[model samples]
Target: MKNEPRELLNNMFSAAVDAAQPSRCIAPFLPPPPRGRTIVIGAGKASASMASALEKIWPGELTGMVVTRYGYAVQCDRIEIVEAAHPVPDINGLRGTQTMLDLVSGLTQDDLVICLMSGGASSLLSLPLDPLTLEEKKNINRALLTSGAAISEINCVRRHLSAVKGGRLAAACHPAQLLTLLISDVPGDSAVDIASGPTVADPSTCADALNIIRRYGIAMPLAAMQILESGAGESIKPGNPSLASSDYRIITAPQIALEAAAEVAKAAGIPCHILSDRIEGEARDVGKVMAGIALQVARRNQPFKAPCILLSGGETTVSVKGDGRGGRNVEFLLSLAIALEGEDGVHAIACDTDGVDGRDEIAGAFISPNTLDRAWKSRMNPQASLDNNDGHTFFGGLGDSVICGPTLTNVNDFRAVLVLPKSADHQQEN
Candidate 1:
């Protein structure tokens, strides 16, 4: 309940994450029990938690399996939760995906298939198409991630290259009625873009994937190129009959998470303005723009005025040109700090709700009015750190890194900028 900058920002973030937790949001969207069988299958960072929630609430007997990222598994009475690597595919993910496909095969029309999907499913549900080895797929995935490509573009390529994605998984469950409950982490919450739309039809084509590869200059493997060039990797189109019995509901989304944070800010009597829930771009570039907006509100009192909190949610891409040790959230914060340049009365926090930014287990970092001053005092060059994309090191040096181990939910990035009035005399906390 503390209104101090650091504590308030952390509280808002926690609220945002809690609002999207599977247990809180998944119950209302559950489908009725089918006459024959209920099969639950899914893949994502939050899939296991969703399964656990469903296991607790479903009235009828259900059996299933779901794959989640390492360290994200949860216990369920009937459903099995498997752990797999994320942001890149591994043998465990490949086998898990295959097992899911096999599980849904030959189900009767009286059966019901419940799919719990969230962010990170693209990598967690990995199954490379023929002629494309898992190693090659991993290479392509790594390239696309570091290439500054937007998630939708990256997922487009992934859908084309995967054996189970882009509605193929839905198609595999043909006779059975499929109900997919999603925790959206992508901008706009497009059904086809969520985990590459494993249980929904895809409107994107192989040519579109090829165009994204060219746009990002991602080095594609020979087999990958062949799959795209020859159109052999085409995904299930929107009108495909296999998706006739498929339906999906976005149980929670970035907007809902942002609104939760806004409620926290409002409860503390601070005016809160939601910038947008779908802002997208390079992390540093987006940071610069946000910094400009914050500065305008701080100096000119334009926009939303001082003593206000600015909130936004979306996935930002990092080009990873520098061997930085942080994710997009930290990269955005570091750039924001550099751009703020020790501006007074401005504080901010940027973190991924899933509690892993980039490859680090840390969520993200916070920046205060004297963030640069503290860094300089510690012999840390803010500009140099930003250039090296080493936000984890920079923020960690100042004890500003926000660490919350694996929050079993993913709703993309959460950002809060607190701008106080110039005459106010509250010392920055974190």
Candidate 2:
């Protein structure tokens, strides 16, 4: 019996995520044990796992703290694990940020600070600057998430607003040799963009943050706006002596994840075309463009023949016009399904490698030739759901939502579009 295409697609996704797991990738990049104390601290979906991975091979006694999104924590005995909100800031995250700051303060040159930074760290390390409350930071964060601003720009704002982000954490560890290992989830894998570069020097400024806020029309509190205007939130620049002893490396990224998926396709005798690992923009628009490419491959075989996978990885943005509960991956899948119009010989899957999409529990959703038809049969209006940004409920109605709780790793979004020949129509039903 031939393996099901959907199973293959799921396997490909698993491969992508597995390639970025902290345990597999973090070990090779681990720095040597310091001559003095080892203090580990981090914030992100994968930080907890990274800390746990560090504990296994680290030679000396390690004491540190890492904050991750709620429900994404892995058990660790020595290093404390704090679970908080993601894409949004909460009180727990605020308190955890202060504690993390304290953890690094007063360290001497003999101590070593290892920071495990990854995606979602900005929100997980939410400590507002003076005169800026956590509530204001949360409001700004929520606005930025729905503002269609690029991740880099959102992070720029985050760096300026926080007490622990944008190299501030690294600066706090001054005199202590700081090493940062990252699992990149941003499009370009800019170390400064990952977790707002908590352990790396930031080149962005308050003026840049103000410009982004203005460009996106994001409503900001007066005190926060004034802080940006007064230049009080200016981040530590590249030449800052406070960060002179810091070093960083991106242990894993979207490109690596996409390559892993491609290898899986190769093993299965399927031609895989990695369209791009840095595709960015509106999710629905990106979906439409991807749908067109898949159509061309199916109808003309121009780019490549059937029995191939068009894979792309990048973090897409969703300007929330409707009050719906769906992450960028599902939103893209919903839009792709609508654009495909139930075309035969095509199937697709979109999911975040971290196993959480937007603020929902589901990772993402699936798209098949019958996706639209099934929705119609179920009396679910796909367009209405899409309009309301309710792809979660839409796909849930058809039982197509891919739910795999926290995968404990993140390399950004993984998308696969499988186009088969007419001879393989039987596989579409399976």
Candidate 3:
């Protein structure tokens, strides 16, 4: 009763983001000084900050390039930081990725290649394989995003189309000691799914990419299709000698962030249930399932009693059937609002840890028991907005959207539903 539900939710979110920042989690994982020149290359929202952290304590010469989202760049003296478009590939990203690939090429056994890949790398490092133009890669990327395909599925296609993704980047560093450190933004923390596993062994084949395209009905450039069908786009498979000497590890992941948030709740004397850090599905559907659990806790206290928080993390997808502004976090929160129907004793927040959800700069939104009622009074039709995929506008009108621009970390989505029980709410109000 001492901390309001909304404030507690916000605190938990901040804790989650703080736990994943590069400076907080990158130091202990830094490798020892390499024998030869150390070339660092990476791409993601966190790459620039990661590079900066490495430079602060690195004993060896650090020189290389890393691509980050347009506004997420941090000052790094040694590594060149290239700011580029994210969630969508651009010419700048393409150039940066090509340069990275070139830097790792022609390395000797004594040379070391350090990769710092994270979420958004799949788009930030966008050099298409030959015979496939950048324009073609861009088109397929757009399609996969709107096609409601899962992150792993989308990344599979990206790996096959790119010259730098999959295990090819590590392959390019053959004979050199290649070490990849990632801040995982994909569910299950599959090494092969994080930024399409640029420096890890990829077990997926070109056939898997073709299957995803067909399953999603994604239209690919004829040239790309031909490459896949002819097996020319096949990714470097497991057991490939090029990756045999490479080492890969995740320094930060969704699970780590979620557990950090859970600790905050525990210290506050609130029982916290960490359901999973690998949940995935359509955002709205996941919202409904979450609402059901919250209802049980509120009305029956079957799973967890009052004054508890249910925490989860992972990337969720949006099919984007409507013409409205769509951020997966907002989409999930909106659907949750509708399902809960002003149900008392339940308050929740959903956000992407990176501070950008879907295509918007807005991180995400929040929902309270009165969310729907407030919207109805303001003449905002929640259902209509949801139908148009306009959760941002709907939440914005109510001044409930949680906007924390450019947290500069990517661990995927964070959702917290606080079930207070009727007694706690009354106590807080009094």
Consecutive 10-residue window with the lowest summed lDDT within model 2: 421-430
TM-scores, all candidates, are 0.98, 0.97, 0.97
lDDT of 3 by residue, 188-250 (tens): 999999999888878888999999999989999998998888988788888998887799879
Return the clash pairs for model 2, or none. Answer: none
Clashing pairs in 3: none
Preferred candidate (lDDT higher): 1 or 2: 1
Q: Hey, what RMSD does candidate 3 come out at?
A: 2.0
Ranking by lDDT: 1, 2, 3
Indicate the residue-level lDDT of 148 in model 3. Answer: 90
**lDDT score for residue 156 of model 3:** 93
User: In order, what is each prediction's RMSD in angstroms?
Assistant: 2.2, 2.2, 2.0
Per-residue lDDT of candidate 1, residues 199-261 (tens digit): 898889999998888887789889989999999999999888888999999999999999999
lDDT of each: 0.92, 0.90, 0.90
Worst 10 residues of 3 by lDDT: 421-430
- Candidate 1 residue-wise lDDT at 234: 93
